[model samples]
Target: MKETDIKELNERIQKESAFVDMLNLEMHKVIIGQKHMLESMLIGLLSNGHILLEGVPGLAKTLAIKSLARTIEAKYSRIQFTPDLLPADLLGTMVYSQKKEEFQVKKGPIFANFILADEINRSPAKVQSALLEAMQEKQITIGENTYSLDEPFLVMATQNPLEQEGTYPLPEAQVDRFMLKVIINYPTKDEEKHIIRENITGAFPETKAIIKPTDILKARGIVREVYLDEKIENYITDIVFATRYPAENKLKKFDGMISYGGSPRASINLALAAKAFAFIKRRGYVIPEDIRAVAYDVMRHRIGLTYEAEAENITTEDIISEILNTVEVP
Candidate 1:
């Protein structure tokens, strides 16, 4: 927490962040233009939290994640969730093995370090629940035997907004488990032009591994060591508390804007994400700016809006901005 310690930690974060940046740059070769989405994914990786990405099809959601896995030298698996997908399909089930004379547990794709839950909304609640224990507890139980996933495990799930006809909405409880919900938008005209040129000319960019799984673990430790001052901690607490009781803070703008506020998990994730954001920015100690930078992603899915707010077309982004402006920073 001291200035000298902060300086040392900052140096360390900068070194690790360089590695992360190198990996991202390599991913950019195949992925066109999604700088914001890529940054958020890195933050999620640094914070050791799951990400829920919402975007239209062909936006490179899956490609970005696959490229990230390649850069990190981690095991990657993609599960295509469908309406008929079953929980046993995702979590794997015990099969009778006559040779072994016992039921053997077949591991599912969830065992990988980087799991891409593609079209997550297409699956029903039962199938989605199959990921609950793995996402939250970092372990899975099958056939009375529990297995802990390897370190640096992360779930990067994507959902298509344009097609939701038969999809099951992710419950708030499940949504809360995700650290951030990133919205990937269309690319700029210039970026799209570049994308087309590369494909037409057959000039594919190659990606090389920049960091190993061990490096990710080291970065995570560095993130945990980042300091948070008492004043800044109080500021974070106040912001989260305000969500539960908007009237106490004279937040009339949020009175009809929210039906349910964020949970304790939201507060914890916010703090963790703030630390990661600071670490990514080459800072050892979290500043008010770090919290502000990640507030929307950390709290958007956690907060539920009222019917009137929905009818008025009020979004979580708008409400989060209001909270940021209303809350006095320390």
Candidate 2:
């Protein structure tokens, strides 16, 4: 808490986070744009949390995750979620061995260090829960055996917009399991020009591994050590509380606009994500700016909008903007 301690921590974080820039350089080799998506993925990786990427097809959502996996020296698996996907298919099922006269555990792709659940909303609820459970527990139970997942295990699930046909919307509770829900946008005109030139000329770049899985595991611990003062904690709580009771927080206009507010997990993720954001910035202490940077992604899926808000074309983005503008920053 002292000034000298902060100085020491800052130096240490600066040294620890030096690899971040190199990792970013490697990712940009293949990815043309979507800097926000890449940064959110890094925050999730550093905070030991899962991410949900929602965008229309061909926006590089899947490519970004693939490029990230390529940059890290870890196991990666991409599972395509379909309407007929079963729980056993995601979490390994028991297999009978004739020679051994017993059932052998055949682990599913969930055992990998990094998982890409492609088109997650295409699957049924049971299949979705199977993946979500593994994401939360960080383990899988096959038959009678419980297998702990490998360290630095992170899941990046991509889903098409719910308006897409034949898509099953994830349940509220199920969706809440994700730490961050990022909405990807199309590239800018200049960025798109480069994208077209690269593809047309067959000049797509390949990302090389810059860090190992252990490096990420170590960084996660350091991210937690990033200082969060009481003022910042109070700021996080107040923002989350305002989502529940807008009238009490000086945002009375949103009384009926929000049917439900964020849960306790929202506050927790917000704090953790803010700390991680600070770490990514190579800082040892968290600031209000860090919290603001991640608030939209952390709370977007958690807030439930009312029919009145929808009728007025009010979105969670609008409510969050008001909360940030009205809530006094620490």
Candidate 3:
């Protein structure tokens, strides 16, 4: 890309940055901290992918998604996953109407634009499977009728990592369907103080509507048009390739640490995520830095570690950092 092209792209990116900043401002009203978490959510929205948020309870995971849905003017639905939650409860069921003397398809909460699957691990695999199909295909089939979901469909599922009691862990296949698995940590001392003060005073910031669902859909279409240079594209491919074959890529530390690396979806998601990151940053063409910025979130949950690595207390973040350091930049 030429300097002139870069300048033009940068200009466009700056304009888009205002829209992204507006979203952040709205979310900041209800959310005290977790800026990175909010950014990952925006990236997921721009990239048109689902997200799995892992955190302890009371981290504002539910509040954040709801606030975001409000800001974007999207329909929001929250499903509290439990042990007895049935598939029909998630995907809707067929009901026989007495007046019509025909079976009617009553849609569940999953038909909304933005759905929050709260404590998703609390549900069994069978229940999870119902959501999996909808998350992947953006549609549900009740009896013989197939219903397409509303446009701009997104599932922001949350899971409690600290507690496992009576909880069914999400299968690896189900986890892979999510584009990013974001981990939300506790707020800082000052942010916590702010939260306490706001709660005590009954004064909370209000999130104003920044963009409508239509605007988001248009922005997503614009993101698809964002350019990716061949060198940067090769760079993303090489990083994902290195994850699978660490030794070949000269990532010796990762050889035993990782039993399985990211799949082809990782590469594709990386490119799409980088474009979204760039789009949010007000750039039209993706750069190596954009890929590096989002590589961890995109690859963290996709990579599976060995038992030894787990016992050694090595985390996916550590492995991702190593891969980032080891991979050559374009």
Candidate 4:
């Protein structure tokens, strides 16, 4: 692209992305900290992918998603997954209506535009698998009828990191369906102090519905048009390829640490996520920084850690960091 075209695109992006500021201001009124978490949620929504949130309890994980749902004109549902949760519970079941003399298909909470799967790990594999299926297909089958979910559908799931006694770990295949796996931490003392005062005063601000559902759909279309260079595409491919063929790519240090690497979906998500990050930054073209900004979330849950790496206290983050640092930027 020419310099003049690039300049024009950037200007257009700035004009279209003005709502981002409004969104940030409204979200901050209710949320004290965790800026990264908020941005990741927007990215996932814009990219049309599900997100997995890992954090300790009482970190405002639930509140953040709730506040976000309130800011947009969309249907929101919060499903509390427990030990007794069933597939029919997550996905709507068919109930026979004697008056109608037929089975009526009732949709579940998955039909909403935004879903907060609170404590998703508390459920069994059957429930988890059902949710993931809806996420991947963007629709669900009720009895003999298949229903398509509404557009702009996003699932933001939260799971406690400290508890494993009653939790069921997500299978690798199921976890791979999520586009990003965000790890959130506690807030700073200053932010915490502000939170305490605000909670006690009963003067918490609320986020108005700033954008319509169509606005978001339009923004996503713009995000898809964002420029991606051929070199940048190759860069994304190499990063995912490194995870699979580390030794061949001169990353022998991680050869034994990684039992499995990212799949092709990782490459696709990385490119889409990088484009969304660029759009958020009001840029028309994706740079290496855009890719780096989202690399952790996109690749974290995709890699499988080896027994040797686990024995040595190595984590998927460590492997991802190394891969990002070693991969040459175009």
* Candidate maximizing lDDT: 2
Candidates 1 and 4, the one with greater lDDT? 4
Q: Which candidate tops TM-score?
A: 2
Residue pairs that clash (backbone atoms under 3 angstroms), model 1: none
| Residues 150-259 of candidate 2: C-alpha lDDT, one tens digit per residue | 98888999987756698889989988999999999999999999999999999778988899889999899889889999999999999999999999999999999999
Answer with 2 or 4, whichever has the higher TM-score.
2
lDDT of each: 0.88, 0.92, 0.89, 0.91
lDDT of 1 by residue, 228-256 (tens): 88898898888888887887877876786
Q: Each model's TM-score?
A: 0.95, 0.97, 0.95, 0.96
* Model 1: lDDT of residue 21: 64
Error of 3 at 140 (Å): 1.0
Tell me the lDDT of candidate 4: 0.91
Tens-digit per-residue lDDT, 1-330, candidate 4 = 788887888898899899888998999989999999999999998889899999988888878888888888788899999999899988899999999998888888888989999999999999999999999999898888888999889999988888889899999998889999999999999999999999899898877898987888999998988899999999999999999999988789888889999999899999999989999999999999999999999999999989999999989889888888898988
lDDT of 3 by residue, 11-59 (tens): 7667755789878877988999999999999999988999999899898
lDDT of 1 at 221: 92
After TM-score superposition, the amount by which residue 268's alpha carbon in candidate 4 deviates from its true location, in angstroms, is 0.8
Clashes in predicted model 3: 3
Worst 10 residues of 3 by lDDT: 8-17
